[model samples]
Target chain A: MPFWLDAVRRFERAIGVPVERFVTSDAYFDLLPHLKRAQSQLEDAVAAMTEEWYRLVNLPSGSDVRQMREQLSRMERQIERLTKQLADRDATGPTPTVRKRDQNG
Target chain B: MWPLLGSDLAGRVGRDLERSLWRARNGLRYVQAMSRPREGATPKDVVWKRDRAELWRYRSETPIRYAPPVVIVHSLVSRSYILDLRPGSSHVEYLLAQGFDVFMLDWGIPDERDADNSFETYVDEYMPLAVDAALAVSGAHEVTLSGYCLGGVFGILYAASYSEPPVRNLVLLATPIDFSQMGPMVAAVASGRLDTAELLDETGNVPPDALYTGFYMQAPTKEIAQYATLLENLWNDEFVDAYQAMAQWSRDHVPLPGAATRQIVDDLIRRNVLASGRWELGGREIDFGDVQANVLNAVAVKDNVVPLAVTEPVMQLVGEPSKRDELRLTGGHVTFGAGSHAFKHTLPALSRWLADHSDELDSPKER
Candidate 1:
């Protein structure tokens, strides 16, 4: 093993002491909420601007893509369920015979 | 003695010169060859599929030794290809050779769309669905569920939540239980230098670059030192090959969904939820003591990310002492799954343990 690996390990251990002391202090957790709020506002502004640009171009937006993705995902699940049902039926063989009705109507 | 020394020194110089010339000639070709490192070299079929997740069953030529199929749940933070890295260095290949039908549930790369996906999405939704699919594909009623790192956290939560888990055996590789025992990254997060929720809000999903930043903070000098070692051993083909492969694997970090990031920050890192055993999902209480499956808590002793303290507590929480086993080996986090030591020592022992606990070997026809 290289001598530096031991040095790195020792350095890590040395740094942990101060980090632990700093983190567990009450002041650290207190600052979190404020940071979260500011970031949220900035994100919203960026999203709104991006959405507007995409809208002006007459192209689908992120929201539109997300909606389509969800729709396709649901369809995929439905297909999977129907495929499984068909496989199960094939495995056991069909039990009930199909009856023709309402053709006259 | 002087003449002998002189002749020996001359011979050594000649050999070094020859080796240097050889390296100079082939160095670029070697670099090019290493650049095209093939990952997930094992052949597998997609047995089950869900949104951004798939269960793959690897092809096996030999008869499966164990009846209970093994399902590996990979850490969401990175790609699952680490377990199936390459031909000689694959955990999946080793398990398959041991006559165990193996399935890997890979959570493919998450993007902004998956921002809404939370711990609930994985523990309550995708995992159960994947388990059912694994059972269906393998024709086995029960499975040996193995998880690596964050994936193990999900596995443990799932195992504890279900009244009677469909899993016969549970394996946790470098899984953290006590978040309080987390390393400097957790310390830095707790220090309030940055608000995790706000960071997640800015980017709907936590970017890989941010995750890399956190990892780098833990050992700032490690990456630089690794590069130094790589350059020093550039003339050695074997060293270069291994280093290149590992370097590529390390670089392939995945984004974490925002909601998932929030939960990890609040529930896991800050609150130390897993240690509390009061964790709830979908109004259901998840107590670690509720898990009854034969458990193997395999921890890498030298693992900096999920250190010994972070993982050791879970062994005490499990209900059955006889069922709970620990395999403490000396390696870093990812090395347990990919390193040469794992192939020779840990993997074989792990395979035997699974085989011994499983009743699947008794009835091949049933499978």
Candidate 2:
């Protein structure tokens, strides 16, 4: 093995133990929520800015496309469900209508 | 003494320089190889698809195994191509060659619309349907369900919920049942360090990067170690190809549905529902003791993502001790699917187990 390679492996092995312990430790995990919150806020800001840019340029934004696609998908699912229901009803035959017995009685 | 030390130092420097040059040359080749497309090499047909998820049957010229079909349940976080990575290094190919009918449940990328897709939907609705599809296409009455990572969690839940499950044998590959042992990922959620609710609500979905980054944080030195190993083995063609293929798969992550993420937070991470057997779905309590399928729980000894402690509890949970089996493999998280040792030991062991328990084959008249 190369001298540098040996050194690198040694360094990795040395740090691997402590790093694994620390990374999974309670102290580390406890701080993640705040970091995640900040990250979410940052992402929101960037998304808003991108949308604004799209509006200014008179081009369709990502959110707009997503919304439209979602609408289309929803319609497709509704149609599929309806089609299945129609098939089932046909297979099962029509339900009988209730008799007008109250007036006769 | 000074002259001897000087000569020794010179010789060491000379050897280092030569090795560095060789590594640099190979490293360049590694880079070039990486640019090529490197996943899903096996030909497959989408036998069935529902919404974003699809059940794929790999095409094979070899005769099918007499055992019931095997369907791989991929994790929600990653794509399914990792199993069918390349021709030589594919788990799907090996299973196919071993005569097992291989199918994969690929949960394609989820969008904002899938935000409401919850655990109940996956375990109760989609999973059972997928199993039915696999059984239908293969002409098998039951399927040997093989769950990888989070997929195993879903598999366990499904098996527990259904009294007469379509699954004949349950194989869990590095699946985490005890969330408390999931290290930093669970710790973050358990301690309120990572507010899964706020993140899901704000974003409507957990993007691929967010999920990937969470795993990355668990082992910060993993990438460095991986690259260093790559550099060392850059000269080997086989190593380079495998590395490139795996690296490509690693980058291709899928966004997890928001509702599912919420369930993960509340049920698994925070409350430890699966471990406690208190998780109920579709009016059925998910008790592993109810699962009657022959269970093969394989846990990786060196798995950093899902630690050994995280996976070991499932043996006790199963109803029958005689039917329960465990294998401690010698690789980390991704190795069960991609490692050479897996192809040698893990896949073959699983195949034997399936064949051994095959009801159709065991029955003389049916055979």
**Best-fitting candidate, scored by DockQ:** 2
Which parts of model 2 are misplaced by more than 4 Å?
A: A13-22, A39-105, B1-38, B201-203, B359-367
**Residues B123-237 of candidate 1: C-alpha lDDT, one tens digit per residue:** 8768887888887777777888899999888888877776667878899999988988886557656555567754652337788887775565454555655665655566687
Error of 2 at B163 (Å): 3.7
**Candidate 1, A1-105: lDDT as tens digits:** 558766655665577557655544555445545665677678768877899999999989777786776676556556665775676567553221211112131
Model 1 alpha-carbon miss at residue A5, Å: 13
TM-score of chain A of each: 0.59, 0.59
What's the i-RMS of each model?
A: 13.8, 12.3
Question: TM-score, chain B only, every model?
Answer: 0.90, 0.87
lDDT winner: 2
Clashes, model 2: 2
